[model samples]
Target: MSRHIDLAVIGAGPAGARAALEAAHRGLSVTLLDEQPKPGGQVWRAKSAAILDAPPTPETEAGNRLRQSVQDSRVTHLGEARVWQIERAEDGWKLHVLRDGRSSPLRARALVIATGAREFVQPVPGWSTPGVLGLAGATALFKQDLALPGQRTIVSGTGPLVFFVAAEIRRLGGAVAAVITPNSRGDWLRVLPGMLQRPDLLARGVSWVADLMLAGVPIHWRHAVSAVDGGSAVEAVSFRKLGADWTPTGEARRMSADSLCLGNGLIPTVEAAQLAGVELEHCPELGGWVPRHGEDGTTGVPGLFLCGDGAGIRGAAAAEIHGRLAGLSAAQHLGADTRAERARLHPGYVRAARFGMAMTALSTPRAGLAQLTTEDTIVCRCESLTRAAIAAEIAGGANSTNAVKSGLRAGMGACGGKFCQTAVARMIAKAEGRAESDVPPPTARPPLRPVPVAALAGDFDYFDLPIPRPAPL
Candidate 1:
């Protein structure tokens, strides 16, 4: 039997949570689903540890309020629920979900996808080492568990996250060996107009930088991580100055470290949106590929809307407003008048989006990032496929991401294509002498994520299964 809902929001992040609250307040039956045990998503994830007694920052305060509201709301919250497949039904959408190792079906008359975003880490030598993790992953450690990556960690990457993580480590009594980035000071200068749109966010970024400087952390601009050294765990990190095109220019300098926190920036997590039949377009400014939708989160598909970072790369501030607009639009689609609600949210959404986009553009990885990987560097960690191996497939007529996958099984790992698709597509574009956009991402398939066969088996028996008759001979 399928559980039916008036509105079903995927992802209980800032966007999805807000959307659910809005719809429920409007008298719609709503359900909010997420893989995490809480509703704040990554930006506002609920802290798990109580021993640290970490001081409250603006982010934590806002996140706490959001989570509290959701907890007090009438919307049904389903944590640890994973949607394996989604497709259209007679009146709306049907979702095949796996929860507590059991498969169930849910049908929603309206849907809002606020799946959010993931970090982009361009491959570098020794990046797969044990002590190396992305900036976002490092933040999550301290944010949730009050844990540190190591005593002395080297934070290397682009975007504001690099600085934020460095400061976080210092606050946690961990040593930051150094901070390195490929973006130059001029790159940030060029995006100042957008950053000015949100003075509060800009000030927050400045505070992070100030804290890093006060801690005597050396900030290296126009530089990129060349390699992480140590046989099994990170012992040191090497970096070199970058040219105008972001290519390595100066001699490589080494820094002693116990671990490396690296990230290029963020890319929208569009798998759910794509599976929901939402159209996507590559926008470098908004963080790689994002769903195409109106300001109100209305997409070409009726009753199926998109919001938050999943729709684009806007930060949590914009995501909250975007969620409200999406919820209002979704309600309107269900025949409720939401003009006043939509009108109130549109301005804040636009302004926050402007600032977030500026930061995203400044942090976007450059083409030269592809050169960081040597021929033998591992690009696909699960398959253990090296850069040279993937290039060989491309040289042999593997034109698209799917074609390369078909040849080398690059995306056949447990991760699906989340980690390596962008890098693989970059390799294809470089080898084919074409733009990266020319190489579309691999086609999305059902069971969006891997699931146990037994969980999907449900209440069925082989003995009772209908058997097909043999063909006439």
Candidate 2:
């Protein structure tokens, strides 16, 4: 008998974990599907025994709470499962899921998507160096295995995340070459007022800054990484200070570093959303193309809702509250009484989300970052397509990002464009002399996360499947 879930929450991140707990608390049988082997999302991904042998931080503690709730609650937590497709069923929805080289169907009355975000790595020369890792990858490596990408690394990017990662790397006993940020002092001052809106967040940033300072790590302000240098792995890096327009203002500074952590900001992972036939709009401030949803996480499609970074890049605080909102709203729609929950928490979620938007606006990358991409710089590292190749496609009458993808195969790689789509769109926008929004993101299709063809074509054993209970007891 196929297991039927009342509400299914995708992802195991802060949003998904909280959403599962909230729905379960409201007397709903929820099945939380996560791709990770463990419960914590990327931000709070569990540490190995060696790493966890040390004490935990508040974030870890919070993650433990959510993990415990999901573990202790009746929520059916399915790890290492990839939800490939969602289709309309007679009663509600049928999700095509692939796991352990087999496919199965999961029926659900309602679905909550909290798949979270992917890093928008700013492409630079030699970025494909062996030692280079995305900001999120760096964090995951540290959290999962206490693995530092390099001995001496340059943690450089456009936002506050770089600072946080740099501090964490140091705490993990990794050496830092420098922390490079493209934002000038003036730009930070502009957001200083908005940062104060959430004193807690502001204090966190202040503390990261202090830790760097105390550790004698140099922070290069108003600078952007120009290139990574190495024959195989990262050996050194070059960066230049930028002006208001993001143009290089001075000579490039070169330094030695074994590894480089790169990211401009986070992009919402919307493949699952797109597969659900959810409408998406390009909103740069919220991290590229995002699924259309309301304050209560209601998508245009009934019985489907979205929350967390998958909905937008509002950080962890906003993600938690939004997850709660989406959960309670979904529960209320399912005939559960959550008015008190929504009434009490909705306002705070909106308030915190506003501040997050403000921060995203302040850190929203400017057009000047594209200037670093020379003809030889590899834009689509997955396919080895250089900036010139994509530009040539543009010159050959490729009008949209999809057209470029078709003609140039920039996104036709194992990564499936997660790393190249934004960069490709920006480059196309520049070449066409149009706004980036003019080029829509490449359409996310079925088999969203790459799966082996055999997995999709194969079936699992029915005999081993557990018999369905009458209903949630």
Candidate 3:
């Protein structure tokens, strides 16, 4: 008696939300499933009604519009449903879902994966401590729950997210000890001329950095956090200077702070796609191994598409455009739209995707990251693999992440390899003298979120609902 949907979008982030709303508007029945309790993915993580009712900030208002648009009767919002797998059935695909200690299945004519991405953490000394958190985690605590992790916080790492986190912390009336960025001001200068092609975006980026400077938040360029010092929680951090190649020069210094927020970058959550048999490729510029997606979000599998960070790490704007293109493509495949409609949407999608590609290429992880690790540093907290162990594995002819993982069991942890995979891949790549993109990532399986077997057994009919059939001809 499982319910059937015309389109089942397996994420409620910007991409999935846009796809669901667009598909529903085009006279298709849509079901939106998200692991979280609300619609907004990590980027827009706020309470559903709470966000809608709040006096609109410019940021909140845009989300408000999108939220209101997706509230139509044709859309069924299934919050808290964790999809374990997507298997190709005789007709379309079957999605096995687990919800609240129960299991159920649903069939959909088409599927759009917008599972999004997660923050990439490079293991450093004391990274696993209680007070130490990822940049995104800190943002989530402040934005969603209006809670601060500590009174004083040091946000470190590279990329635009570091600045965003610092702004949020300062906005929340928390003391920002410093914004430590590994990228030098010269790095920004090198990318600035190219960024000038989009004056508006350049202006916005400059304004963000300028605001931080005006607020007296010390911006440390060419510096990286080497270690976090604390017993049960983070109390201070050690930083080292990077040379021209981005390697730490032997010089180091320390700063006292209550919390250490670190993030190297983000990687696409491709578990669902991989489980569905989607082909993956290692694109260092776009995180690690991401699914090979076409320009219009179509995967090699028919009726299956990827959009947003799940496809690769593009910002929210690009994710939205990709979602719309995927929805249009799905509609065309379903005979819901004409050829002309598809043709019209194609050009806009291309332009946005090109912009995303350029941004991704320029901001890709630098080579200097490998120099951050020390022999005593833990590589995998879950498996207790030390840097020495990984180095030994690489020296012993393990050239890829899988081989290194099998040799040292670095990624076989409770978190399902999320934390250790990137670091392991990078280490293997460096040892073998291969491009980071040459190292294949581990196979992604399900259940996407770890569920206790007890919970699965208790709720056998969790995903069960009456199936809806079309009217007879």
Judging by lDDT against the true structure, name the best candidate.
Answer: 1
Q: What is the lDDT of every predicted structure here?
A: 0.88, 0.84, 0.78
Tens-place lDDT digits, model 1, residues 1-473: 27889999999989999999998888998999999988888888778757436787666777788888988888999999898899999999999888999989999999999999988888988999999989999988877887899989999998889988998888889999989988888888898999999887788889988888887888999899999899878888899888877888768999989899999999899988888887779888888888899999999998999999998898888999999999889999998899998998899889998888888887777777788889999999889999999998888899999998888888878988788999999898898899877887888887788899988888777889888999899
In model 2, the runs with Cα more than 4 Å from the true position are: 459-473
Choose the strongest candidate by TM-score.
1
Model 1 Cα displacement at 462 (Å)?
A: 6.6
Point out the higher-scoring one by TM-score: 2 or 3: 2
Point out where model 3 deviates above 4 Å.
48-56, 193-201, 354-363, 458-473
Q: Give the TM-score of candidate 3.
A: 0.90
Cα lDDT for residue 255, model 1?
90
Question: Where does candidate 2 clash, by residue pair?
Answer: none
> What local lDDT score does residue 83 receive in model 2, on the 0 to 100 scale?
87
What TM-score, computed on C-alpha atoms, does each candidate reach? 0.96, 0.94, 0.90
What does candidate 3's lDDT look like per residue over 131-154, in tens digits?
A: 888988987876566667788888
Q: Model 1, residue 373: displacement in angstroms?
A: 1.1
